[model samples]
Target: MSERIKKELALYKLREIEIDDMKLKVEELKIGEQLGAMNYEEKVQSSMNCKNNDYVMNEIETLEKRIRFNEIANKRIDNALKRLDIDEAEIVRRVFIEKKSITLTAQELFKSRKSIKKSIDRAFEKLKLA
Candidate 1:
């Protein structure tokens, strides 16, 4: 369970970074559209039926789907954290989400290293991840 939680935390961090990058890509696509550089479609539909925004939206649709997937994964991680007590959640976050060592977390949280380790063990017992 501990190992699984750690792996999920790592994936959560990765998904978060990916979501941010994909959002930036979407923004760049929009900026390109505004700059009259919209050329996302390889083949044209009827020009009478097609609007300018419609041209690039097809491309943005794929990117938005990827962004939404990562967002949902992050939300699941958030919900799991919400199930924990505040202190348990904080310890888990510092140890896993922040990638901090028990010793470092102890120093930051003003607790002993042994205390931090105990809290981490207790938190791991209660944590559920997907």
Candidate 2:
């Protein structure tokens, strides 16, 4: 690839990694919340000891901020995809926008499951560049 193209690709990949990391962080937060709830139920006071309570509150705040930022980045990617004029945009729309599964989206888009997945990945890369 040309230097410019390579740079764009790198940017796209970085954005994708950011999105994926944010999603993982959200999952971690949910797991933390569940565990916290369980712990609190067993012993509310123990779970909220001064230091632990501060730590947990800080963690939740950070997670919420990360989730919000990720959501904004997701919207930016979506807008970028819309501008790319990619024919598979509808497939993306159904899968990401409508939040459908790969199998169902493949059926809707008349593509094989693997193709659908590749399309999604490429779409992410395509939109990652500013």
TM-score per candidate: 0.79, 0.39
> Which residue pairs of candidate 2 clash?
none
Q: What's the number of clashes in each of the models?
A: 0, 0
**Local distance difference test, per candidate?**
0.80, 0.63
**Candidate 2 off by > 4 Å:** 1-12, 29-48, 87-130
Clashes of 1: 0
Model 1 spans > 4 angstroms off: 37-56, 128-130
Estimate the lDDT of model 1. 0.80
Model 2 agreement with the true structure over 48-128: per-residue lDDT tens digits: 454565676677678668667766766665666676546567666666555678899888768899988777667656655
* Candidate 1: tens digits of C-alpha lDDT, residues 17-103: 899999998999888877765344522655533565675787789999999988998898899888887987898888888888888
Angstrom error at residue 21, model 1: 1.0
